[model samples]
Target: MDELAAFLRTRRARVLPETVGIPTDARRRVSGLRREEVAHLSGVSVDYYVRLEQGRARQPSAQVLDALARALGLDGVEREHLHRLAHRPAHAPRRASAARPRPELLRVLDLVADAPAFLIDHRMTVLAANRLADLLYGRRLQGLNIARHVFLSEEGRALFADWEACTLDTVGHLRLSAGHHPDDPELAALIGELAMRSDRFRRLWVRADVRTRTHGRKTYQHPSVGPLEVHQENFALPDATGTELVVQSAAPGTAAHDNLRLLASLGATPAPSAGGGCPAEGGDRGGALPEEVA
Candidate 1:
C-alpha cells in the first residue's frame, strides 16, 4: 500500500462518527468517517477524496491538508506527518552522517550529578551518559539503542514496570523519527530488523502512531532497587540536529530518591545477581560514546 494512503486509512478508521458530531446509525458499515463525509467536511469533492485514499492523487494543497487534519482531529505531530506524506520527495533524501553530542554537552550531562542523564540521537542511540545513568542503566546503557533494547531484548522487557506502555511510547516516537528522516538507512535497517524479529514491534509499527518523548514520568523496576520512579525530561541540544539530552530524576525525600543514592554508593558494581555493572569509577568503560549495537 502507498504509505500516505495507508496512513490516511488508519487515521480515518480511528475517528468515530459520533465523536465527530455525526450521529451514529447501525446502517453505517464503516468504522470511521466515510470518504465522502471526510471530503464534505474537508470541502473537497468525493472523487478527489477517493483518489487521495486510493493513492491515485498524491499531492494535496496546504489548505486541503489542513482541512483534512481538522476533519481527522490530527494533533500537531500527526498533522506534520500528514504534510510530510503529501510532500515527500520522489527519491528518498540522503542518509544523515553519524551524529555526535558535543563534549560540552557531555559535560553538562555529567553536571546533572544527582540524576540519570544521557544523550541520545534521533534513533535513540545512547550517545553519552552521566555517572548516575551509568549506575542506573548499567550494561543496558552500553551500545544501547532504546527502541531496539525495549523491543528486542529480554532485559529491556523487564526494565520498565509498565512494559506495554513503554512499548507504545517507543514505537510512537520511532514513527515520528521515521517521518522526520525517512531516508535514514540505519533507522530503516533497525525498523526492518525489529519488524522481522518482534511480533509486537510489527503490530505497533503499522498503527502509524506519531509522538516525541519530551517529558514524562516513567517507572523502572530496577533489579537491585526493586521499584524506581523518575520524571524524565528531554532537551534538544543546541546546535545539534536530531540529538537530545534526557534526564531522569526522582522527587526529593521519596524512596526513589533514596534508591538513587544507594545505587550511586554501590558504584560500578551491580548488586549480586542483579546483573550489569556501571562504568568504572573515575571514567567511562574505556570506550567511546555512542557505541553501536551490532
Candidate 2:
C-alpha cells in the first residue's frame, strides 16, 4: 500500500491540470492537481482519495482504480503497476522461478541470422543469444545480469553509445520487473547490489519510472565493427512467463547494416544445433549449458 501511494503521488505530480482539461490559475501553488481535483476527476470523495494517497485505505475496487488510472493519465504499463501495488496481498515472499530459454525459443533466436537477437528473463539475465548476437556483444554479457553489467562493468558501459539513456532504461526495466515479482529474492538482491555500487542507478531508481519500452532505435559501439545504429524490437514469449526475445536490426544498404554483415562474417560459424549446449555459455560457467546450442 505504501508503494501504491508513492506510485500514485509520483504519477499525479507529472500530470498538469490544464492537460487533463482542468483550467489552471496563475495563483495556484500546487505542483500538480490537488487532492480534491484528483478525487473529483476519479469520481471519489476527497477524503477517500486522501486515504488512498496516505496508505490508510484498503484495496480499492477495480472500477475506482480504473477511474484513478484515467485521472492520472497512466499508460498501459503504469496502470498495470498501479493495480499490482494496490492489490498485492500481504503474504510470504516466494522464490522466483529459474530462467531458462526453451528449446523452441532458442530455435527462434537462431532464425534471425542477419540481426542480433537474444533472450532475457525478468531479472535481465541473458539466457541465450544467437551467433550474431554472441559476436555483437562479444560474448561478454552471456549469463550476466545485464543491469549489473551496465552499471558496474567497464566493458558493459562501453558497449552503448548513449550510456546514460541506456542505463536509465535499464533502471526502468528493473523497476517494472520488481513490481511484478516483489517476492523474487534474486531480483531484490540484484537491485540492492546495484543501488549500493552505482550512484547513477540510485538516482534513476528513485524517480519511480515504470515502462516496458518495446521498440526503439539504439546506437551501439561495437568493439569490432565500430558504431552501429539499429532498430530494437522486444517480443514476449507467449509460452514462457517473464521472458522476452529482443532483436536488433539495421536498414538494408546502410552503414550499420554493412557493419552487421561484417560482424557476421567475422564470427561466421556453423549454426549451433537445435539440441546442443546453450548459446550463451561462453562467459557463464556457473551452470551446465542447456543442450540447446551447438
Candidate 3:
C-alpha cells in the first residue's frame, strides 16, 4: 500500500553525505545513506521517514508531504508530484498547463454582478470567480477549494446539517464531470485524492451516478444575516474544460434581499483573491447564497 517506499529509497540513495552539506561521522553500513541523516536534513522526525520508507502508513497528510518534499530537496514540479502521490486524489493528475478561462468568459461574469457567482472545475478548483462570487464562498475559509472548505472548515461544514449528504452531492457532481471530460488532468487528480482519503468519497464515486448541478434551493446561516434561503443556478461553460458556474441569490423584494444588500454595502471584497470574492463579481443583486467559495 505504501507505494512511496521505492521512490523514497531511490531518493535517499542519490543524496550522498557531502552533497547535501551534511557531515557523516558514523561508519556507513548500507548502500544508501542513514535514515537519521535524511530525517535530520529534511526537518522531520526519524520515525516518520522510517514509517514512510517502510510504507507503514498508506496515506499521509498534505503537510507531511510538504515536509518530506523539503527534506528531499525536491523542486517545484517534484514537490507537486509528491503531493499528487501522497494524496492520491481522483481529479488532480500531471498537467502541462491548466486551462485558464478566457477574457470573454470573464466579461460575461461582469454582466452577472447582481448574482453571486463562481466557477469550479471537476477538481473543485476555482479557476475564475467574480467579486460577489467570492463574497458568498470566500469568507469562511483561509483558502478556497470547495472541497477543502466542505471538509476542513468548521463554519463551512455547518452549512449542511447532513454532512454525508453534501459530500455525496459534491463527489457525484465531480464524477459526472469526469464522464464528460475524462482526460482532464485536474479532474483526475481530484478524484484520486478523494478516493484515497475519504471512504465516503470512494463509495459515492463507485455508484457512477452522474448529475449536473444547476438550479436548486438551499438554506444557509450567514454570519451577518443569521439565516437565509437562496435559489442556486449552475451553468456549465460549453467550451471550457468542464467548468461550471455556480450562482446564488435570495427571492426578490423580500426581507432577506434587503439584508443581503446591507451585507454587501459592508464593503466586502472577494476573499483577497485575483477576483477577490467581492460583490462586484456578483453579490446578492438583492440577497445571495450562504457564502461564496473562490
What TM-score, computed on C-alpha atoms, does each candidate reach? 0.88, 0.85, 0.53
Question: What are the per-residue Cα lDDT tens digits for candidate 2 across 246-287?
Answer: 999999999999999999998455333221222223343234
lDDT score, residue 93, model 3? Answer: 39
177-255: candidate 3 lDDT, tens digit per residue:
5544545675676678767766667776664444456788766666665565677888876753556777778777976
Q: How accurate is candidate 3 locally (lDDT)?
A: 0.61
Candidate achieving the largest TM-score: 1
Q: Tell me the tens digit of each residue's lDDT in model 1 across 187-210.
A: 888889889989999999998888
Off by over 4 Å in 3: 1-97, 140-143, 161-163, 272-294
Which of 1 and 3 is the better model by lDDT? Answer: 1
Q: Candidate 1: where are CA atoms >4 Å away?
A: 268-294
Error of 2 at 148 (Å): 1.3
- TM-score of predicted structure 3: 0.53
